[model samples]
Target: MASSIPLRPLASQSELQAFYIGKDINDVPKPAVILDVAIIRRHCAAMLEATRELGVGFRAHVKTHKTPQIAHLQVGDIPNTPANFVISTVLEGETLLPLFQELFRAGRPVNVLYGIPLVPSQVPRLAHLAKQIAAGSISVMIDHPDQIDHLRGFRDIAGFAAGVFLKVDSGYHRAGLPPDGLNKGGLVEKIITMEKEGVIELIGVYSHNSLSYAGSTLEEGMQFLREEILGCREAIRQHTHLLSARQAKGKELVISVGATPQVVSIKGLLQGGALSPSRHELKALLHQEDSDDIGRITVELHAGVYPILDMQQLSTNTHTGPAEDEIAISVVAEVCSVYNNAERSTPEALIAAGSLALGREPCPSYPGWGVVSEWRRPKGPGRLIVQRISQEHAILGWEKGKGGEEGIPLRVGQSVRIFPNHACVTGALYGWYLVVDSSREGEGEGERVVDVWTRPTGW
Candidate 1:
């Protein structure tokens, strides 16, 4: 460990102690999204391997999991290591600077981009902060031609060319320049022209593959760039004569192609009978400079998985409960009302496990539903009941056993915390988490708790 940052402000040791054990907040009931550190490191290593094989730089975006501890690991050692990072929000950019400073103190250089913000008032501060850190290397994205007006006078005011990357749509209609269109040279021409005029330095051409959009897949993303890169190369070639005409000059241009998903998936597209290089060869290709001609660029895999582990561990017990199953999480709630006295007046009680946070909606997971845990209801006892889930809350109900008793009983003050099917989103919803350890049961490593870490919320 290279000296740990002070944990005081980042998290409270005592609260951390209580969180891991899956304790409730105040006297009211509460739940947590547990994270496993080992699981995150495993995924990070896998992503790094995939990025390296694609002949592009691997600058893990820390916006997904905005934890300093994880960011340090992703950026490497600086001067001795490569410091390439892609941040989404300004807050993420600010938070990352200190981590970079730490690396600088130890003799490392950090290069990072907090994507690009369209608003006008943001440019100056971003530029200033970039200058403050070692290898500050701040870059932003530009999509439309008119947006450049917001940046007008930037050259006169800043005195230095801004590092910028042109945003290519790449089949994802979310935001960026379409791979091809009448607006063909729209944003790209403006950016390159600005660079030629010394307003901003066009470092590279990049794309954002909004997988959630139409025609955006790993293959589509790569193929889209293949054409765009070829197109841009031709555009630049056409400019050769114009260059001589205007006596203009610029260095070789580079294009950066990737989204977190496609970045790792396109590594094997060129493989064949005997014409393909081994994975190791591809990794080497991506890490080298001046090698951009070989379709090389950086891929952004924001550190989403890392946070799932280093933050909190979801609690899952395999033991049987007093109900029909041993490993089920039972919830008891009153029927309140049942339309035609169809049900009892007693508060409903049920075996609650996975809830809406787990991606289960319209209908919640019924019995035999297991996530993070593998438990089942027993064969000999209480009513094995499962019911629907409400937004932000779940309602479980059950009738009495084989006997003549009424429905299961749960008082007004009783409640149970559930383990989420997907822990990542759940983790993002809270500012801090309660932790508990399996080995120590109630004690060990002081109660571990994690603060709600995140990148800048606004652009």
Candidate 2:
């Protein structure tokens, strides 16, 4: 089972004084989303290093943070090299275009992939935007063969080639075609015919192994990875002839796979060199022959939530939950009500953070909406759990003896920080993040509001 840091009161008098010298934690309004910048950078650095070591390209899914500053950190400060990014909404793509344009003007290529399948209505605007920014810099996903027609029409009308990827279903059963027999009915053949006609450019195949998140152990996650690779291999095999034909015309194929669970599992394997055994097998399966005959296969890993972990991420590995320093986001809420449940032999407290603020997503294998940690020291395991949540109330509970001999005496005005079950959704509930440096937290300095970064919300 995963646990939270021990409960501690808000900053002490002296600590509060020190924090007040700048900007204290209590100074911020209640039900605020707090982000630790240091932790996010560390996580991004680790992911970037691991991917670089494995000789694979990384395309960070920006939907998790939806903030350009954090997205920039994920892509790194490298010059000239293109920063690959994936987004879930059209608005996000539009919002990031200016930033991508700036990078392009500075000589660094930046590519954006709208991960969601395109709707006919959205094509004109998307196509126009792609043209204005950088030709072929924006890509979209196409799961169904019919979507190719709409894309082709839009491309002809817009007078530019649009890059696209075939979405392969890797047991998630959510928006993608099955890898095996994908060429049935000459569907892939038609797509290739269109690519030959300059209607659309088939960039690669993409998959999201969401089932990997349900894995209770790292071994289970690895098994999911195997399934994903096998599925992608089948898809590649189905498109081998068509892809080879395109390659002859100077086109490359990308094999992109990820979700946080799969990406993190692969990262761990790469770090331990456990993936070395299967590297040759994967390379053999993914390789294709071209005219000049140098097969171009770029293994692109995409993930979003790994940068800012949550309770669900912590519970993924049962052995030693996520390190205290790894969790970068938390909800700071104040106790609104406290009740003594003599009959149940436990005390309950209501917090200001509720479903609206913290989201209703549940943590697997854990019975709580959020894990409670000390407001001042959020790095340890917590004793109280958020048992229930209403529109504006989170009911926190703990067993009588578990809390203390006298039971946890929570005050009405007391404030505590909660690690949400799902950071992505919880973060969406807030407009901006109250940024803080984790290192300053232990120095008797409360969360000083160093900076505030606005988050993009809505569809």
Candidate 3:
């Protein structure tokens, strides 16, 4: 039996202000994670606008900002339509299930996709949780045939069928099944057969092209997307007979693609004419018609890190890079010491944030763990970089020849905001995000703690 978990009390605005308002970045304790709620709202709006323009649905991946407040922003104010959302963990699904249920009860179409693949041992708990909510409200991902059998056995015991989406390998080569080529593995056929046999209801197909993130140019990302769509189409083509059988039963298919880089690239391509052919191909795939000339297929995009822009997002833009001001989250650290190199040729300042706080993810575009934000020094040279990070200390260094005679002229106790390489991992390191109002004016004086949003960490 699972133990009931009590909900944490939300801190009142006045209570939060007593702890955070009027305190300067330097004075609010070191190595703290701060979130600009205003900026987050702007990012959410931009993503929704792009998806709307592209004529596709947006399913915000809550793995980045694992808070209900942020998730509410992603879903928007009107809850009439299903607020399409995805989660990376069962715990996250459990955490957000009640909210989704409440929305569903209020006549809102709410759907939650537990994006991760599952095993037999985990099916009971997931099924039990799913049973508590609206029928078909929760969906799971499956990439292999045996997992389907496992799900079937669990369903027989539990007396309820679960909705599942096929995880296709869209150049990520990680955990999904290959969508293209001959169906020698018979995965698609098996899935369709199982659906017909009432073992599991096939909800859709999902793909995550991670290669898009490492692609050097925007064209590369588009090419990957093209291949992904082609692959999905090929899968459907090979299983045409099976699809026809399923479609006759009034079943529709969904093509879900994600990864922040690809989502942003697709949005850019849809806006610009530079890649007309690719753009047209994507639109056709997204707006595909069936034999009866009905738009039976729907395209859903799932991305997590866009809500909190980081160094990786900026470098991966490949087009008009995001302005530094758009980055909403930052690690505020205080300088504990300053020292010279062994040869005394360069000086380095040690701060409080490190791998434990900012994460150890590599920033290939930047020289260090993270780049120093120009929030405080808008006109000053943005030369400071987190060159190295220990368990609890981040060593800050300036670009070669950019530091003056005394090496950046930094003093102990000085505060610096470090924008992490990956905001998702960095955000996971903290317990609560100190919400700041970016719309406020002046140097941190008007910045008040509007709320204290707690983050759901761990598995």
Candidate 4:
């Protein structure tokens, strides 16, 4: 059971510093995986900013960074304002509830939405938590009629009308009923009636995507959401008398739509879907798509000794910047040897980090140290790019440098930080990253580890 606790600011900088850098376990040369907190914050912040343009109330998925510290970073010190955290489990909600409950007790409350839809098994725990927690503090999703019936019993048992978000198949089709799927009788009307009768409060409507497909090319997804929200609103109004009463009484219902890819790509397109709109929007939508696939084989048809592959797939964003210089490298191994003899004539080689370090997939070859920036080698031995990856190694090859050993020596046990084609994938691999500033500060050391921060690893 949850009871209101006095609000207190979480630990202090000195304490947090002590906890992380503190002597906790035996030293094991914690082969550090450096993270640029500032840069990461920039990427995450960009995503949040995009939501403003999307014109929806910001409820970031905490799954990206499961740590409370990182979660607070996402919140950016919004005092007296409850952080709107989106999650996938009740345990996740339970872990975060105390933090939010403290805010509520202090008169600065927040809300949490369990991203998963209601399943029969979840009802008992859901009821227990909601009953013990503050009113209107928790919400969950519901898609099928059977789930609603289960929720009704749970609500009755708990003696509290649980908030429900009618799941709609906006586009991604991962969950939620397809927009037309609601036509099999009166599921929509049933949900609307529950809201009116107070058995299940119609808190909001929700949607999701599979995240595997392109998710409707962002533009398509946005258009579909806009139309779905409008259509559902009309459908509810036309069929349900309860919602009509609530509308007449100035009640508002949330229309929550989330999909990192869709949200980031077309957030601004979702304006006017909110029960109420906020003044002054900030940032555009940004999605962290399939960035994990950094170095894998792509079947490029051709004829040669070996068909090499590009390395950009895993290293850079679609809009990656250009490279600084052009240098030539050779493929020590057979040209196509790196890609399981898929084809020939394409160039390939080996590089520093592999699939495990970044994500596993080949990226496009542009001239440069890595795929992070769009450095393409146009002249002579085109740019050397990473192709395939393993947990600790990467396959590299020159796009233009034609021979097995073109110009330079490529060997193992080489320590190199190839500029990643995409920064996000590379950023997530290690626990933390070292910040190095080579510029000297009036006789100070040329480089110093200025900042140290950890990234979220799991739930």
* Candidate whose TM-score is highest: 3
Determine the C-alpha RMSD for candidate 3 after optimal superposition of all C-alphas: 3.3
Residue 6, candidate 3: C-alpha displacement in angstroms: 11
In order of appearance, the predictions have TM-scores of 0.60, 0.86, 0.89, 0.60
Candidate 2 segments whose C-alpha is farther than 4 A from its true place:
1-22, 156-158, 184-186, 247-250, 270-296, 318-323, 341-344, 377-382, 399-403, 441-446
Clashing pairs for model 3 are 82-109
lDDT of 1 by residue, 1-459 (tens): 112223223445455454444332212234444343333444556556655555445566666555675677565443565566777666566666678677767765566665653556666656655655643366667767775655545444455556666666655566665544314445655665776677776655565553411232444434443544444443334444333322233254455554433443344444454533433343343344433232223333333332232111111111112222221111222223222122645334433223534334221222312222212222223433334455554544432323224333333344433434333344445444333222334443322332223323233
lDDT of each candidate versus the true structure: 0.44, 0.73, 0.73, 0.46
RMSD of every candidate to native, in Å, equals 9.4, 7.7, 3.3, 12.5
The residue-by-residue lDDT of candidate 4 on 1-459, one tens digit each, is: 322323233444454445544221112123233332444455456555554444345565654334454455555455565556666656556556655665566665556666777767767666776665666666678777767777677677678777777776755557776655653356767877777677777765665542312333444444444444444444343434434555555555555554443344343444455422211121211121111211111110000000001133212121132322211111111122242132445545454455555555333334443442221222334445554556655566554444443332333332333454333444446554444222425432322344444443322
1 versus 2: better lDDT goes to? 2
lDDT of 4: 0.46
Q: For model 4, what is the alpha-carbon lDDT of residue 201?
A: 77
Q: Tens digit of lDDT per residue, candidate 2, span 1-459?
A: 001223223344345334333565566678888888888888888888877766677898999888887888888877877788898876666656667787778888767888887777777767766776777777888876667788876686567778888888988998888987666567678778887888877788888888877877766655666677668767876667766766665667787887787677654454433455554344333333332332456667788988888888777772244435667888889988777655455667778878999999987867878877755533222467788899988888762235444545667788888888899899888767777777664663536766677665765
When summed lDDT is taken over every stretch of 10 residues in candidate 1, the lowest stretch is 311-320
